[model samples]
Target: MANTRAAWARSHAKLDSDTIADAIRPLVEADPSIKVKSIITEVQSRFNYTVSYRKAWLTKQKSVVKVFGDWKVSYQTLPVWLKAMTAKMPRSRVQIKTLPVYRESEEVQGVRVLHRVFWSFYPCIVAFRHCKPLVQVDGTHLYRKYKGALLVAIAQDGNQNIVPVAFAIVEGETADAWEFFLTNLRRYVVTIDGVGIISDRHNSIDAAIARSNGYSRTEQEYNKNYQRLQERGEAYMHWCDEIGVDRWVLAFDGGHRWGHMMTNLVECINSVMKGARNLPVTAIVRFTFYRLNELFTRKSAEAHEHVRNGFTYSEFATKRVEESFRRAGSIVVNRFDRRNEVFEVREMPDGSIYTINLAQRHCDCGHFQVERLPCRHVLACCANQRLDWQVYVHDVYKMSKICKVYRGEFVPMGDPSTWAPYEGAKVIANWTLRRTIKGRPKSTRYLNEMYSRDMRGSRRCTTCGKEGHSRSRCPQHAGPSSTGGQS
Candidate 1:
């Protein structure tokens, strides 16, 4: 049996690279995380053929490039791809900005290098017209040969579905880059007035919005406010003064923003595009187009089916309303005014009182005002007055509005062979932006408060029988006389 196995293994050891790559292409495309060792093992287990690690690695690389296209070529083909996309979908907007190449401080006249690219599909822009007026903007770094930042503007439709409206690839996250992105966004996609923008407390965002809005406040006046803010240790107040609270803060947004305080919506979209960010520029754009197409189709069908089934509210809103209704049963309500719109609600068990103002669509508890949905107090008041609770629900949460958001269809970009010839200058990446550090690239996300957990209790040192440091790094094991030396 050993002799027979040896002969079989020897015969299968020299597997053809092309054959191995062909067999692994589907697996690689299905999961980019598959290791070379795992591919070799899988090949052996599935095909009963042995392969070397180098061949497996090369095969994976070749298959990936073949499937996703080469990185440099993808950059070169960006202009053509954008032109083809716009031609296929005329309503879609695409803008490419380039700067002349500089050689040792002197510009190489007329030789342009890619500086930024901005685009918004027709379907996305049209869908946003029917969605909420609030938009969340955020930026994430690109993990590729030519390092850059991807800026995204995402909005939540009536169904609470994230609709990506615009995307921009910039040299980096700076004031000018954000200004360029938001300016184009305003000109192309979000043309409606009173549209609220939400983002983090990043300084660049503040400067960009101020510049875009053309704030004419004098520097001395601004400096006075800044000094006062610093003295009071109110940095957020300073930001609000500079960028206008209506643009970033939820309270001052006057219901235009619909109470979205964070850019988590755009961040969610960024996380969804994690794998694609490592691809070349054209591939990244293609991935987004295809992914959004899938999302629009799936969500539109869902909304249509829900409406057909007679659902007035979204699944999420329905669940929340039902939960509030149940909680309303335990509360007591007393009408305070002649119109019966103002009421005092008291929790039976705790004797906690809350003021509910149905006229203003607000409650002292704040949930009703922020969520635009009746809170338990408001629901209790409505129940006591025999008023319909459905009227308190926002129209944006209705199934009809949701269907309208997904009604627009995403047109397909036809075959590349049928594309019009790009008559403009070739757009090449800025060489200065290329990563020069010599080390293996890190694909892991930076640790944040949300993703981090207190693992101190789980960490136990085998050397000292203590918590915190590992056995290899344990101080007890680091001593010269300790038998358990550092590994």
Candidate 2:
């Protein structure tokens, strides 16, 4: 029995990369972070063989590349992959921009170059047509050779489901790149007036939005007036003037921006694609396609299920309506006219009066105006007038509208070999964007004032248990040795 076991171990130890990769491909795909030791143990249990740690690690590396494709050769396949996607789904749009090698410019001569690329799938476009006009845009860094930035534009459906509309791969998060992305997005994705864009106060994004004529003049003037009343310094006021309050501030954006104040939705998309960022550009795009396909399939099914259950609105909207009804009891309604379309609701607890205009679907409190849902005041007025509050709710929140957004089917890109030839110049990573320094790359995120922590608050020292200083800077902790033996 011992001799047989030894023979089995020896046979397993001799397992080649291809054989080991085939065994672990499913495991890797399921959990990309699976350890080498786990793989070795699994191989030992399944095949009655033992493999070294180094061998297992090497096998896992090769297997990942095999399954996901080599990062080095991934960029060359992007055009073809996009072409196949567009063929399968004709409504899908893809644009690629490449920088030509110029002999006159010594800086860019004889280097791998692909400047930027943008793509928007058909289902996402169709879905956004039924969603709110608000969109959130943000960028995240890619991890791999020939590093670049991944720009994402996302919107929220009536059901509060995040719908990704467009994606772009740019050289970096510069003004030019953002402008290109916004230009493509405006032309192909969100070709509608009164669209609200939410993002962090990134200078590049502000410049891009300004150049694209993304906001209306009314929004600009509203922001200027709003900022003029603030106690912010002249420099901050000037900066706000340059960027325009309508670009980032929700209050000054009139009714176009809805209530979205930040690009958190786009950040969520970045987190979803965290694992794929380390892969090649083509693999990253492929991963996005598959992930989105999965999302659409699952969300569509969920929407259908909700509708089948006879839900009038989404679960979130339903809950909000119920909450408004509960609060409606304390609100006393007074009609302004006989039409009953306009009224004033006075809250008994605070004696604050809010005007509810059913015709405009608005309230003085701003909730009804921004969310397009009946506020507590509106609900109270509707109750007093024997009117249906549901009529005042926006069409986008209705179950029918939510269902329409996800009804479009996602067409599959059959096979790579079947893809038509892409005769464009072989796209490669711009080496300028690649990190030269060794250690793990660092990533930073910009946070709006609402999300940012108040570091100006008093801090306590860990050692002395006092406020206004840290442990390292605590005066009470100063030792006699530091006083040159004076103690």
Candidate 3:
């Protein structure tokens, strides 16, 4: 009996990913994020044999293909999918650039591979018109079978709602790729002039801005801040010079940037969707479509509800205005302009005097013109002059405009069977850009000096009772010390 069992064990068929994946396709369709361990358990329960981790991983990947379609076929069918999207939603912009396929040194005729593609939905393009006149651009890497970068351009609404206006999947953050995205963003999505773009001081970004185009501090204040940095070290000042002040300093930003200095808005979007990067190229597109559709639906409903409730501004804008109004009561306004449009405002007690020029839209405290909202000083000036203050609030803050942001309506791209027949050539994936790194994929993100900076000087020497050197490096740690720092 023992011999028979051993023979049967030796003779049992080994499970390949295709067979396991076929069995798990239904499970994957139910929940795409099902784990490999669960898959291994499922195999053991059904086949009475356990699979190795690698086999389970391979099977899970195969299940992804089965549920979402083949990665290779996804690349081939991408052009059809994009065409269908445009046909369903006219005026939506989609641009795809392809490179000729090369084998060794020779180019293959009629065969092309995807180089980069940028897209902006019609709703998002229109929504930007009502958003703040500033855009923040950011880039993140994609993982798994594909090698590339996802570049995004995002805007902020009066309610501080993040509006993703444009996106591109590109080869990498190369200068050429940035140029393509920047030019397309300006030409298609951000059509208005005088709109500013905020990004990290990448040389690529600098180059892109030269082709395309906040901080709202005063020049004198900026000069003083720079002087303090210079006193600390020349290297500090040199670093500031390397990254031009105009890019970050509000006062020097030419009034185009609305005092925004961080690409954190774009990063926030990227971080929330970090896990989605592992999806196949076509799945990535579908994922973005569904996510944005969800965003627009929820936001549009909220906008309508807010308007119905009699709120004339966004929740965030309304809160800001109310706070300014509360502080305005404590301010004393002195007339400056003969027409009573400008005034000198002094807050009670020790607060400094601020020059509020209603006609010129200038507030020395740097809030009125910067945000286009009536600051406390501006509100005080208006109150003292008996001028209507609501006019000072930018039109972008009005509920009617915020409602227009999502009113364009995202037309759902239904079943492919319902899509019009596509006659265009297939989009081929660049075989050269395929990921080749072996072993369990290492995290592409790396910790930098900033991540560990806080650890510096945090180590305490046990014997010396000091917060500099560690116990191992302490002078008295190993030299006849009977007690530790606490002792």
Candidate 4:
């Protein structure tokens, strides 16, 4: 019997999703966003066996649960966790709306399903005050078990750093949802008057903006940097036709766009945070905490080092101002104001002349007022008069302000075992939104002929030669089939 059992064990062994998940627990704990293809290669390397794509995907889901806890429980504990976070870091704002649950004819007691949520960390709230007074808003789809849309607001620092200000999770980009997100964003994050909001002209956003004066932050506030934007021809005219030409056309904006051409700032933040969209709700929030904390800590230290190195302006401002100084040396200045602030500056040899107003921080070239930085003409005017040119540079460009942008640090969230008991209604999930079918759920997107063709002839991954996310984002940078130099 012992000889027969030994022969059977040598011939066969069981491979399952649970076993795969257990094997990759360390990798998942280290990096929760590790790719499934990496898991398959790792399992094969360890056990001398392979697993199917579906099983690998299942193992990932299980591993995520092991590392970050269950998705359903994440929803239930979200409010409690948020309360603890708020207590630890004062002034952090969070609003959660839950719909009441019902059974037959009677209402459920102390039970509710999540409707929407909005959060703005205190550090981000503080950071915005020191950034450029322009805000960019955008939304991206969430592809987890609970389908939702993440609305994000981003601001840009003097050094051109991306500052994520606020975020919200909603059912979709419906008018109501946009209204909720925009209203809260205006009230909480972008509280300054005369600030500009940059966004794509999505119909839902338009509808929400039209519904009330208080909805979108773009309620007649100005855009400053008209000269910097490279105007697109047809779409520019079409956008003018749809929403009054004032919003898109910088001619109407009173120098508030701040050298930004489009809504790329928010789009950039969306890409940076989209990797965690498929994570559990609590994990998504946790990911934000870790990501933003890392960002602030690094930037804060960098800003201090720059200050210690005797940098009065941010690196971005320093580079631009230095170039302006070089150009100012050659340009000839003609005094126009008795205060020695305003002048007409001409280029070296023979060139067109530009008007500069040091007091107003204006230039006929439009660089001074729009960018809030001293243009060549302004520098030339100041140099001809022997006046200090640093006075013309905006405070936002100063290293001191840049340091304040990241001064707020995130507090570590202690263990949950010490958390105070929550007194709010117990949260429930809307089961109707769950993918209740079998196996992996199919995309609900209506596949046209072109999409179908692409699906049929899809290309495989470059790194592992497997069909999925790209090489950089993929964990398996190389596969067994890849041949290279000596190991």
Candidate 5:
């Protein structure tokens, strides 16, 4: 048995691993010529009869080391390899400095972090003595990856252009964030007495002001204004009073503070940036700069036209009005109950204003918010009354704001030569495979004769079940005329 196994091994052994393995597999199978030793049942096992040559061959086989083909390898392997390769490459360093670190009630020295920085110039109001009377402030959510919100402080300039003085991005829209943003913003905006600051009725600013007032020596004057919080917003007024921050009584819009008054310049800014909302962080900032440049361009043209048309910023009418109408006293204060869609219009009487009810479909003002134009109550009264509803409109709802922005000139950014459309994007054809037509049997004599005959045939109308005609030409389709047969 040992001699026979040796002879088998000699004949099967080949030059390469694959050929030797293939040749030995068949000999190990069940056979009559050699009595199988049955030392191992598995075909993968080699040489049941102990042999030195087979042992050496197995040892030198390199253990079938698996060098996996690219397709079979896991995706992470390439990156690991690349990282290893890059470790051999070189890099450079620049600056070093010392700074104070505050931690665990101790001051420690730390290297100062340096950034590649540049200076930017923003138009700021150093003195508010003769500045515009209206200051509009608003907050916007940052567009891209950075999780933060931006507070924009804007005002209408001499050219009727929205001048963004200072803006900041905070971690969140909390009172702390708003206070931090506003404290910095106030440094840029010079507020004159009687100048109204227009902003959403945010509690943070109120809370911060309240905190400041609490620390102020004039607590009596602050408490009087604090009592007026109830008149501002029932919820906000209560909240402010509870927090002891009630000094900004005159700072609010009286009725539905949101509806009658709020600064919507940020809304206009957002509308201008709607096209670039989903862009990358760098792109959004770049686009914002571009939009600013466009605003300046339009303002430059408007400035030239201002001199030609004798126009001033105050003379520029944001709202259209008909000539020959008195805008005062026409506005009757009205309350709209959205739940019931009813409007209660109050007209001032001898002592108090007289109240009238107008349903949702009909306002005493006589206008539905349809077409977004003021109705008669709003038109005759609000427009006639000189009341502004522009404040109540949510930032996104303003169509004119969006329309005016896109109309501004914008140069396409980046090099035209490097720009390329998505690669290999083909219009995929929705191909529907048509079933092959079963060839009609060669016209048999029996069918030909039957169909050809004018009156006699097996074919019949499927609908009416009449003989000698198909459903398409049935007499019922033609109408109850002479007969079922065609002419």
Candidate 6:
């Protein structure tokens, strides 16, 4: 066997000394115990390297191990062996398995398909600034019982955290829906100053605010904002005047469609309330915001950061309010009215009259709520009508929400190559289950079964086959006393 092995090694050991050292470099660093001999042994197991004859050949070239402890030759020889072996090694490609997609089911209803939302849904600074006390509002269809759809709006605090501020899951996204949203919005807004509301631009906003009699102090404030539209030469202001409610339109920018514009605020809320979108109606009603709170909890860091800053809402607190003031003249708004399950787009006489049906919920212009993005027709209507085009649109996106789902929290485990050995080991000296067998009450199934078997219920040594004697404490062992027993 020795002769045959030597013959095989002699034939295969085609490496020079330098190749050996390189092959063992990683092994020696990974484990300090690994020396030249260890590397040679590993290589010998994997390949028939003729180290014996090569030793002398290396010595003539001043590369052989002179003394037993002289490891330099071993180091130099390793690189040579590795160089030859590396060339000889066959390369094989590996295929990776596809990750399983977790199918949607009842248990994971509110789970989002994309990324988890760690914050409140206020996509734009305008929405964030204007809609304070961040509200998590959502809507669903209720066409079976009523002709309209239901919209639920809830308020949240600085932490992207939520509270049930106000909710109106109504019949349709009409003036009635907007009225409910505004009524709840106003009720919530009155509690704070510089109140900003976040909502999708359902035409109801125009109608709800329009129908108010300039009736109360809140109504008067609303009408005052609306009346500003007229003072600024907005085309929709004339419609408001005709309806005896012209005083309520807070004019948006000119030439922007409401649907395209309001998406910022709506999308933000949509992200946070994502999983709830396809959920059963009852579940949405019960724990919609509750589940949202759980998602926010995962973002404890951001919440803490906001709390540290006094919750001074970054969404809008830093905005240049005057910039909005400067752009008012270029904006326009086309007013709409809910008529017989449809919407009537009331534009200037020079402009066209397009119909937006809230009941069937289709706009003659066709961009009412289907695509969810605003159409140019809406923009044209907005421009020709002189509505604040900005209000019809949503806000700009935030950096944090746009990131990948797994980013921000979990970074890859730091390079294992650079990690040092752990400095300390947890010492569990004498761990043992203290509970008694029969006299004592039953604790667990394992313990109960042990007692039933008429055993003291302690672990025994595997080597000695004796109870109370662990493998470390076997009397047959002729070493120092061992410590502790297994449970």
* Candidate of highest TM-score: 4
- Which candidate, 2 or 3, would have the higher lDDT against the true structure? 3
Candidate 4 ranges with C-alpha deviation above 4 Å: 1-15, 29-33, 202-242, 436-438, 441-487
Q: Which regions of candidate 3 are displaced past 4 Å?
A: 1-56, 102-109, 202-216, 442-487
Candidate 3 lDDT over residue span 1-487, tens digit each:
5345434444444466799999988887656667789999999999887878888888888788777887789888788888999998888999999987668999887667899999998889999988999999989898778799999999988888999989999999999999999999999988888999888755343332232222337766767666766676777667658778777577766667775666879988897557566677777787777788889999999999999999998887789989998988888889966997768878898777888778888888877777888898888887887889998888888999999888877787899999999776656888888878854666678888766858553765443456777646765545445455455
Q: What is the lDDT of residue 303 in candidate 1?
A: 94
User: Which 10 consecutive residues of model 4 have the lowest summed lDDT?
Assistant: 221-230
Q: Can you write out model 5's per-residue Cα lDDT over 314-405, one digit (the tens) per residue?
A: 23232322321344244455544544233444444532332223222333221232122333344433342344644323222233332232
Question: Cα RMSDs of all predictions?
Answer: 12.9, 15.0, 14.6, 10.8, 30.3, 27.2
Candidate 4 matches the true fold with a TM-score of 0.80
Q: Model 6 compared with the native: what TM-score?
A: 0.25
Best-to-worst order by TM-score is 4, 3, 2, 1, 5, 6
Task: Tell me, by lDDT, which candidate is best.
Answer: 3
lDDT of 6 by residue, 1-487 (tens): 5345434534554554556544544553333223345555756765555354344233222211211113223222222322232223212111111112235634333222211001122111112232223344555443111122345554433222333333343334667446646554554333455333544444444544334422222234445766665665666566555644322222221112221223244445445544333222222332333443344345445535544665432343224222434432343443455233333444444555565433343445433332222344444444454544344332221223211111222112244344434232111101121123322123465555556635767776544466776646665443333334433
lDDT winner between 3 and 4, please give it.
Answer: 3
Off-target runs (Cα >4 Å) in candidate 1 are 1-18, 31-41, 49-57, 102-111, 202-261, 437-487
For each candidate, what TM-score against the reference? 0.75, 0.75, 0.78, 0.80, 0.33, 0.25
**Which sequence of candidate numbers ranks them by lDDT, best first?**
3, 4, 1, 2, 5, 6
CA lDDT scores, all candidates in order: 0.78, 0.77, 0.80, 0.78, 0.38, 0.37
lDDT for 54 in candidate 1 is 75
Clashing pairs in 3: 214-257, 215-250, 216-250, 217-251
lDDT of 4 by residue, 342-449 (tens): 688789777877777777777777677778888888887777788888988889999999999999999999998887778989886667666556556667998688
Output the worst ten-in-a-row residue range by lDDT, candidate 1.
210-219
- List model 2 lDDT by residue over 1-487, tens digit each: 5345434534444477779999899987766557788999988898776777777877877777887888657777888788888989999889898876555666454344678999999898888899998899999887656667899999989888899989998988899999999999999989998888877656454443333333223344444544543444465456556876656554456777677655768889888877677677887788879888988899889988988999989888899999989888998889999998889888989898877788877677777877888889888988898998888888899889988888878877876687787776676766677778543335476767765447456776654566777756755456546667664
